[model samples]
Target: MSLPPADTAPAPEKGGDDLATLAKGGRTNTMGFVIRLVARIPFLVIATRLYGAEALGRFASALVLIEIVALICSLGEKRGLAQRLSEGAGENRSAEVNLVYDGMLLALGYSAIAALLLLAFPEPMFPNGTNSPYDLWLVATIPAFAVTEILLAAQAYRFDIATTVRTRAIVEPWTISIAAGLFFYLPGTRDAGLALAFITSIYAGLLTALWPFLRTYGLPRDWRPAPRAMLGMSASAFPLVGADAIERGTRLLDIFILGLFAPPQAVGIYYAAQQIASLPQKLKTSFEPILSPVITKNLRIGNMEAIAAQVRQVGFWIIAVQLGIALVLAIPGEAVMGLWGPDYVAGTATLAFLLAAEVVASMAVVSESVLVYIARKRNLAISVGIIALQAGLTVALIMAARNAGFGDGYQAAGAAGALMLALAASSLVKALLLKHLLGAPVSNWRWPLVYAAGAAVVVGYAFTFLPEWIELVVGIPAVLATYALVIWRRGFDEGDKVLFRKNVVPAPDASSPS
Candidate 1:
């Protein structure tokens, strides 16, 4: 018995392409985020230029629902799907290829059923009897959108993130904004542009998103998954979905629930603050695609030590970056919200809560990604219980605030903070449970907490001496860059520098450690 030839085997991935893969996707997403962040300014400028507050609030409310629905449809399968395809390739290469086809069909089938049901029963689709009939039209695109999601997951398994980033983070949002602008310019399209943009952008992005994956995997040409196989995969997937819903609901449920008591305008202001806080969140999430496949494959091979190590490494990396971003945003939350609209300034308290929650939430994120692959069912149970607890707390808090003679804005802000705090608590609990189950110190993010606080204080002090706009433009980057540079020089392990070599060779034309 001899070993397989080098050429016939999988090429060894230096630094495992973990950082490079994430970097590609992160850069794309961050660019898209920056685009969206920058574009939102113009997009809002355009929207206010055209739609006014009423239309804008309605649009925000509708989008808020669409996000909820999208999260539900995703069903925690993005990472799961990628893990399956990647590990399957390692175990049985040919079978993994077929898994790709079968997985896509299963996802599309599920999405189709959900979308059609909504399309047919447009009159009361949401569980809470929320969302509009127009939203049903948006739901109709889920089948195509989710199918593309499966394709992107497949690509992620292959350690190819460029395609996923382009389609998902860049093309989709960018196209939607463009379409909204073009469509709304027409007299007849004015009212329908938002929903139409939702539908069109989903399908539009799917087209480009699927292109690369299909080129590599081909059509579902030979994929035929068994009934039990699909169900088994879905079973593992369901808890993941539950955990994700819990995670996401903790974020969005407050807005929806609180909306009943407050004016749409108040909802609009809180939502603005919510988005401002969300900027830092994307930095944390950018690592999941790269982390999932690697973690899953290691777990499959009984590499518990590796699993624990990788989880901590990825966790620290993400939290450090997210902490820095959160600090910058926290310091200028008021100024940032003011740029959105003068009225949005009322959301300063809301911004503070959400930003604080994101920093807290980052701890839960790293642990959960590993937990989902390992003790997925147990992890999910914890997530479900906590979400149930949190949702109830959020409702009671809103009720109390409303009844206590608080103003609409104050009540709305209180509800938002309570909801965010619930999320922070759940995150801490989940991390602790994950630590017990995995025998890993997933809660070893204490150093980053120090870093986040230090970054905030340092940056806040620097910006206090400067004017507002200067703080935003120069001061913001200055604070973040200083922390990043400092941390890179001190905190990071040697393995982290391997990332720099992925894109550039020899560190320059020809170089050595000499």
Candidate 2:
């Protein structure tokens, strides 16, 4: 395929075109979320039911370190790559290609060192113990995962969100779910099923991303390793890297803390809740790929007002959808968790808090999309403070639960509550900072959201009166429908309705045109 010139690409000067682009991405990813949700349930069922809580807990613990390390090794290219490409690529398609490969090379190098260190000292990953000898091989996934991020980001720079939907939302989850099931039944692989499955999925997703990346960017021509230039790139990315790590850290830090204070079963239960809550989180994070490129383009043209408008538009979209999801899952949290097994039912409270956390974190996540460009140092500082605050609150709350002689479930709920609080604080602070920086109001809140949520809660509460199975089967849709109907009718203005509409092309008149 012949690549389009970077400079000739559509600039979102018109608000309608920008929103349409965002809505298109949102719709694709919303479908991807549904696909991911369906695919993820099977893995949760398999891991929690077959492997049991202790094994799942150990796997979850190890994954926290592995994923965080992988993200760090990627050097914030997930968002930074968009800015780099936007500023540097100009009309030179080859420059764009070379820029992406620069990040890829850096990520590969960092991942190699990180992987080797983890392979040498594996205790940080598996704090409890190894599930199997094959677990150690997970270190190899670091490079693949890191490289995949840069490739996907490069694709996103061209507004190719479908690639992300295909790789992250489809290939990754299905691969893991299927691989985990198959590995569980294989001889000598049961103990290592989850770890091995994760490794397999990361590489699978990498390949899936690499295909489109090659088609879009092709192979770099006349590109060579430049350590001095690469070093400069690394320095510039430091603030972004820290911001990304700390933002992600706020989510994982709770689990890291829980592993120390509570037993494996408790961590397992909490991990299950976290995974469920992460569905909505995925919705917001997926927006990042599309949102980053749009924001960077606007920033390039010094369109602060447009940037603020985009932030508010995307922020509301995220919060409204996330709130609906939170309500649907949290209202029937017990039943949702029960699908994993009876042991997971205790995570209902944790699930509710985690869901609420994701809903509240929407504004912060969207705000950071702009902040990373305009206020990198400030953003990094705020992210550090947010994680620090989260750490303190999580520890205090968990210790308080323990001293008060509460069960592990309560301890886990306390951690969840702390996360909710920390994220809420992050949202407030970040939104205000963005407003100050952009000199425009960036609030996503609307009174219709309150009305919509209240109406949905009434519908959901009524469903709770029914059997658990009915609550899950029929009630979930009922609540979502009610919320969507009310929000659409009362909340969405003409502009906001773009998310549901297709980009229609007018037909040529037979009399006037050939």
Candidate 3:
């Protein structure tokens, strides 16, 4: 597990290799984002139309426990692998290859233990479904889920974002969507059909991710990952694992709490809104794989300013894109939720809060990426605190709503509102902490965001006269176009074009305007 000497590590790449790689990855991830957004729609439609809210709610609740366990088993390879690999940048290629292999080995080991535990004590994980095999399918997906992460992380290190685009954005989602459709037509499968589809898609995506890894860095010929090294690597990643779990756990925590206090239908409605909100949330994640290596390389040389500029640049890019998406989706919130079915339109207000949560939380996500490298423990503490506050507020608000005689749907919306308030508060705290740590702006909140918000509001209101179908179709595009035109003209500078340009060398890192 010992790394090569720091003195022997390769010097940072000169020219614009890093930025070009980032730009290429950015384009790939953006394309993936759009594909995923589209692919996810059918799955949502099927879940709503065929299964109903109660069934979907049970599936979501079960899936949450499975995902939490998978995240635990992954040991943060999704983000931590980049940090580990970047540390060995100048070493032999075997070091990089072995890093990925070792991560997979460790993830599999953890997943094996987790799967067995879930099987032995399924009652705790799936309260009402201990006798059902649906929970078995959930545990079965862990290996594919964990290994897919490791391979995808390895390809990301190679700046091969297209592979992730293909596997994750295209193969995984479509596979699940199509599988769900097929399962729906079969008798006796409706209750657990989505679960089966999820397991199948994970395996498919695993295959797709594996091909790229083998093609790029064919099975490390001579390197047999030692058990000691694998264990040490897992131990090392525990903090990252915790941070990642907390970060993702924040979203699921709300659902878990709601399932306890609210009915299944409410959980389903809120989960539906959560699905739509998560699309813009994907914009933040798409930036992470590309940003990690760059930040790690700069951190190695003590280049704080370059790191800060990259953070701000990427942060602004995320905010702009997420805000525009939030506007487009949330402005037509009721219509968008109605796409699921009439019952889901109750989640319209919840959808807006969830979308707003994503908008502010983008800064917190970018800020934490910095802390992952330099101040991981501090980052872990903050993440724990954020989730804690969210859980407390969610429970308190839900209780108050119930005490005030609000319906279960309103109680669910209360939970969503609490999440929004918590995330906004967390973003402010993290942005300030990152600003202090980097001694430069980690977020670029400026007049452009204000102007873009105003423009979105104006355009959103203007579209009220349109039909719901027209509002969803023409209004969304119109709002996006209006927002993008204004933001592009006013907010984006020449340097900011790095986000969109393909394979073009960016100016020196220092020259990037924050």
Candidate 4:
């Protein structure tokens, strides 16, 4: 395929690289979160209204396997692609296009192999007895979903996060929502409609990601399919791939293992809580694609201080937003879960645990972003051990809960508790390790988080006496504003304001690095 000319975008803003990228990513991801929140309501409504919890649980089970495959096939290019391109460009090497092509080639091959395996051996893929012809048909979306990830990563490397927001935050979820709505009206398709809707969304996202990707990064030029070289590249990404899988897989592991022990209703309810918690998780991740290139550039120049400041600043920002979002979401979690149906309201405790897990885990994710570049193998090892701990804890806790005469809801609560404990342990270990390596604090534990939490409880409890609808509508915003005001007054400085695009401050002296 013929390729367009090389990227010729102007230089990033002077003295504002870190703040600029952070500000831009935060804006786009915040908007994306809003779009996703709006889009998810309809999808959840359709699934719960038509298919109910059992069917949704079965769907969640199958999706876990597909997503695991997609994450592996992606080979960590969600961040790795930007790292490679930034390093290549910094060295004045004309290999950015080749790097992009190579990464895509690896993802396609890996995903195709995974899809074929799922198609060939459907039994292992769906051990939950929800296996169907339609489910098998949807396995073909694996490659499309994985490749689109690389395309979006390529766009992110070009500083075009709008494509990611448009495709992931909008096109994908909205398509599934609309398709599920349409399919719900059809007879005999209730069970399979969600699966089909998910497939449609994946391909839609793929097509949508392609045009903007081509416009920005262009096609591969003189790209020969080098099997040996691609394999080597994939080998280099193995640690990254493993880390990403372990990081993402921990969230899904609960559902998969819970399915082995509990019923689909339990899995469905837990999945609902997981969905709610993952929204705040998006705020932290929105920083990753933008942070990767900047971190890579800084690392090359041996700018450890700047890297340290970057980590601390981003970590603080994530914690600030994550805590506030957590408070608002978790405080009215029962009402939030009730939106799906009254049956899901029992997941209130699970939602709280999941939200706390995300809040604590944000520190670990920011720390890992730095560790992945500096001590990749060590970071991968930590991630593997952490997930192993989570899996073991989840199984042990669930079994103990069952034996102790706890109801199914409490049993699932045990699972969430296990997950939160595991994540907290992982965060502590990661923070200490990263701290020792950098000789600086990686996470900012300011007084505002404590004060904000206390205030949120006081405000949230008082509002709970009102109707659930009024409590959620009025209380959520009130809690958010209260938390933000406290954090703004105490936790943030002028630099933090610049990072959030709140105010223009004179740039720091160039003579003093970071």
Candidate 5:
């Protein structure tokens, strides 16, 4: 909850404060992305091999449910915790520390309630629990999961994303993999490894994630918040949590419905595609910790223009990079999946569709970041409505496909693909609405995005002329290099070069205000 003093004796951020802040987040995010990019391959191998298709599918399904429960625990306080705690540290450290305590205690209380609700309605969660006893432990992880997230949010308020990246991107996934490896030698069933690995990683990640935050911003003291204050905070946060839950809920709802209509193995197959698409989202998430605080601080000073500029710069960068990734994946998608196993290549089409949705949602990412400060309720409302509609539509589509005599695999794929489309439509709408709300202009893709998409296609087609193994080695990198070269020439400015030593921006005159 402590704020770094205004006169921290840092150099003046150039290209305006907003642009400087965006550059900072980009640096942190890029570093975090590297960690994830390194971790992902091993993770895919461990998870797919340990759990196989059926159990992996169930794990994926359960994760979606776990996310819903965790949202119940978030109850909307983390966002406010950051904003309020940051405000209090500036104006009143006493109150700020109290607010931090309140946020944690509030999360604990909500998590307790959420746990009870999950226990109380296990049937709805997993009607056929006989096969998945370990799910009970996974469900019990809600409190730890939720509390960990709140504390993490508190850290992000400090503009410290390294802790988050290490815990989430590095430690958590690695821990899960290691645990799976150990459990592979366990005396019990193979299925037990997935559940055990998940639960163990959640707690381990929580412990590791807290170290830096506690080191920099020690534990909050008695500064207990009043019941009324807690209520107000929770109320404000509920919609925000609901909005996130709905988004996550819709993603999982397809698998849940598929569980009832299709074979469990098909659900697992679809989840493979989900995991592949999630890579870009993980990269996008790394920036939020660094960006959110900057955005909120600018808003506090009524710097709307600064906020808009920052959002546009970061949004476009994220979209551009993710677009390049989507292009590479979409081009050699089957080969990429085949690297996992030949059988998993069935998800190639689904990966293409989902990654496309992620591309469109990149605009929504920046817009939502700004909306958190200007008008969260407006953003939450739109997200909730869209997610709900998407869920209902997914169910209807799946049922219709089934009734029309389609196979379970076909219907399941259709529902997931439809959900991806819905997310795309809703994300675009959110981006447009947020643009109006923030009065930020929709960024016209100046370069690389357009050029990269075209290059990806050409490179992808080029791969077909070669053998699979050779294409795997050359085609992917060729497309990536093409995008990178284009972006360097056509997109990045001199400061980016100076930072990464790609280009040298001339030093500013000593008399200049910078």
Candidate 6:
């Protein structure tokens, strides 16, 4: 399929229009996050209550390797594809489509090699040992997961985020939850329900993404695999791949290390907390697909100030929302974890720290979205350093907890604390570098955030005096409402309010339209 030619020329200023586009994407993804949160609770409950902590821990251990490998196999196309599509816009009708196909081919080749290697030497995947033979089949999902990433990236290049929402937010979570339930009931699949469910959901997401991708870009016309072009593409993608991998590594490395150093029960507790915390992380990452294309377009026009503005705007949105979520969940941390099961209630501190980690990491995430296009090597270096710091901190903290004669819960919290510190450091360093490069102040911090958080905490603390169920039911909404109202009134200006406004029509000129 041939893509329609895009205008590559430097067009007139449309800052509002760009923000509106971003706002639209944000609105869609925010809704997606809510849906995902709802769908995910059941899986967590089932995994914790039914499968038990040891089983869930083993599953998580395997997943860390599988997902990281799959992400690497994607060759950084999740964000890189947007730049490629932008740069190749006007070259030819088939140029853009063929570039996507090239990425798909390369990703497939990488996934195939990775899958086979893991299949032969399966020890790495199951550091704690496999749950069942079905766990080995997870190798097959690597290709599908990588391909889905590229496909979603292709759609995002066309400013289509609904497809991503459908695949990731709706289809994948629901499929996994339902499949996990069904597979658990079947005697033959009971031991491997989580693994099988995960595989099923990944393939379902792949199909969901593929449908829209084909409808949008179709099959590439006269597309032949070119060794030289693909090699160049791979070479160019190295920095992006490193940045992407390291950023993801920071999130998963703690779990991997825990699987090695701590008991499976400890890892399971940590994994549960991490999953709940990752909900807000989704808000930041979901913006990346839309943010990349916008940043790329502005970079093409040398709109450095515009890029800074977008980063600041989006960064604020992410941090604000993440902070609210962290407060809500963390304030009622024990109750939230207890819902999973009594065993998971021990992870309350871990849950709070992980949620805070997501909040602090918001700035770094938004900064990297621009840095990847502007200073790929520098960005990659920073990411590597950050992950290294996180690793060292995680091991040190976990050992310290153990030496102090603490239990597994304390050990998990130590890991979570390390992650929070590392992410805070990343946010500081990356935000500074982005400001230097853009020659403009790029900050998401606002005083109103402090006021809002304080207000929410006070309100939430009052609820903690009541029953746990009351804290969850009545307190959560109260905290969120107080924070939302305060932030809306104090933090959001007319421009910032654009994120919530559905259709922002510019005012007509007095001398013309009026």
Where does candidate 5 have its weakest 10-residue lDDT segment? 3-12
Task: Write down the TM-score for model 3.
Answer: 0.94
TM-scores vs. true structure, each candidate: 0.85, 0.96, 0.94, 0.95, 0.90, 0.96
Better of 1 and 3 by lDDT: 3
lDDT minimum window of 10 residues, candidate 4: 505-514
Predictions: Cα RMSD each: 5.4, 4.2, 3.7, 2.2, 3.7, 3.2
TM-score of 1: 0.85
* Better model by TM-score: candidate 1 vs candidate 6: 6
Q: lDDT tens string, model 3, 1-514?
A: 3333122112237425555655666777988999999988988998888888887777777877888888888889778888788775455777777777778888898899999888887765553342236646688998888888778777766666787888978898899889988987888775568888988999999899876678777766467879887777877898899988998998898888887888888888989999889998887889888778778877877878877877777788888899999999999888999999999988988899999999989888888888887888888888888899999999999899889988767877888899888888878888888889888877767688778778988988778678888887888898999889889999998767777876575555433463
126: Cα error in model 2, Å: 1.5
Give stretches of model 2 more than 4 Å off: 1-13, 504-514
lDDT by residue for model 6 (88-125), tens? 75656478788999999999999999999999999988
Q: Candidate 1 vs candidate 3: which has greater TM-score?
A: 3
> What overall lDDT goes with each candidate model?
0.65, 0.88, 0.81, 0.81, 0.69, 0.90
lDDT per residue as tens, model 4, 389-506 = 9999999988998899876677678789988998898888888888888776666567778987888888988898899989988998999888888888887876676555744444
State the TM-score for model 2. 0.96
Candidate 3, residue 251: Cα displacement in angstroms equals 1.0
Give lDDT tens digits, candidate 1, residues 234-312.
7767877777767777777777665555666666676667766776676677667667776766566665655565566
Tell me the spans in candidate 6 whose CA falls farther than 4 Å from its real position.
Answer: 1-13, 507-514
- By the lDDT metric, which is better: model 1 or model 6? 6
